[model samples]
Target: MTQQDRRRIAAGLADGLSYAEIARRLDRPTSTISREIGRNGGPSGYRPQQAHQATAQRARRGTPAPPRAAVPAEGTREAEGAREESAREAEVIEMAVRAGLPRMTARVHLDLLLSEEGRRTAAELARRLKVSPASVSVAVNYLVDQGYVRRERDPRRRRDIYVVDDDAWYHSIMIGSRQTLEAARSSIEAAQAAGLDRPVGRRMARAGAFLERVSLDMMESADRWRSLLA
Candidate 1:
């Protein structure tokens, strides 16, 4: 849909129109409206500008369309959307890899993130991603060690579910910041042993001070957000 369409949908929501009503007004399907709102933060939190920007970012990074012969007939918007979504998952994997995630780990993490449930068993993930269970196991183990995923048990099914969420973000940030701060401090100490008055020592000291301040600020922000969420 066009940006104008999204704006109209937002306006319609503001006016208290239901998803079905909005779809009727726009001659689209209710699922389209519902999916749009859900992805953009649901009806209560939906913001047209943010949604538009997110949509644009996804579009810019979208995967190339498959060959004509491989595609279904025209007018199958839902099917087409599903195919595009699977293609988009590849882009997510690529972006993760560029960000230093291992290839298999990236795929597994992206799969979990893109999943509707936001959680999956190793076997389920491996099946869905077309990889071996052993591969998924190794990837998830690495992800857990890196603070990217959490392991949980399904009481009803007796299977482990790997989850990724705000906790992962908070933990990863705190861990990385602490490590950086420690390394910077060590550099400063090493430089000081030589001579604090020297240019190299001054540079190291300054770098350490900057990183220390940044780490403190990040930790403070993370704590504030945690309390707010709590």
Candidate 2:
């Protein structure tokens, strides 16, 4: 879609127009509008110019089509289906990038999540993303450190598969909770050391209290929502 189209959609949303209404005004199919907005972060987070730029970047990174081989009718249909999925995957990668993930990191994360087993070896991820294995290694390592991914050794293959599963979020949230608790501890200690009578100490104490509460709430929410995610 064009920048003008995006702007119109944003305007329509601000004016409280329904998706069908926006589609009608744009002279585009309703599905097109819905998909476009969804790909760009939905109504709440959509940025017209950023979406346009992300699309352009994807076009620039486009790989050449592989030569067609002789195949049965069903195989040809499957190939076509793969192409459609690739298009959707490209949209999702762009959206993830706009949501603050680095492009390559987003690509790797999506590939692992989409895989049948929710995992891929570094070599496999690199091959799929058309990047070096070292690049994939870096991305996966970062993800592992952040608890968004994990590694499991495949004994036969003698290689590790980067994985994303329900446990990934659990690990990530728990890691975040620990960090928040640490922050709370340090800030409160600083407040005490600096003297609570001082303005800075009082401010730090308040901040620490807030972080402590937030950490507790995060742990509670994770426990509450864990079953659903599982």
Candidate 3:
């Protein structure tokens, strides 16, 4: 994080914006913002200048900076590092929750996402998340139903493992775009049925056309960029 990023974080906190919203504005992950604040005196006490100076001091002392990508929660070198890592992950879970996922669902997804295999059995998930097996079951079931996750049977283990693949985002985006396009089609058909020559019908027709264009544009852009996930 830069001095400017710290300033924005401070400003975001002052304005009562959630870490997730601030992350969106800064184009950084919510975890990054979370760690930055956690190491620097926290929300009510954050001062950008002090945080910058402290970071500079760390650089001078050869202390490594946190990685932008998520890190494993276990095996951190120091207690402080572990705390920061946990805080970062907590922020990510909060962001997921804000995006409409239930808390345990978000936690389960984050755990699988951070794992080396991009997958986990219910036993492992329950163990790591410290939640009941039932909780993991409910959360993973919900995710699978929403098409945000998938389950595969582990032949060797004789159990099911939930996997969050790279294509999760791409698939979700396409599903959303398809739904919007369907809506656009329905609106356009209705407008036609009502006679586009009429004033209200003309308005509806124009709106539907706009929706159609935007939906198609979104689908095209998503497909073009989907390769980045690989």
Q: Which candidate is the best by lDDT?
A: 3
* Per-residue lDDT of candidate 1, residues 167-230 (tens digit): 7878777777787789878877977976888998888888888888898888888877875534
Better of 2 and 3 by TM-score: 2
Per-residue lDDT for 31-69 in model 3, tens only?
A: 577778756765556899999999999899998554534
Score candidate 2 by lDDT: 0.78
lDDT of each: 0.75, 0.78, 0.80
**Which candidate, 1 or 3, would have the higher TM-score against the true structure?**
1
Candidate number with the higher TM-score (1 or 2):
2
Sort every candidate by TM-score, greatest first: 2, 1, 3
Greater lDDT among 2 and 3 belongs to 3
* Candidate 1: 10-residue stretch with minimal lDDT: 64-73
Better of 1 and 2 by lDDT: 2
Query: TM-scores across all candidates?
Result: 0.60, 0.62, 0.58
**What are the per-model numbers of colliding residue pairs?**
0, 0, 0
User: Model 2, 92-189: lDDT tens per residue?
Assistant: 76577667776678779988989999988898886666667887888888889879999999999789988899889988898889899899989999
| TM-score of model number 2 | 0.62
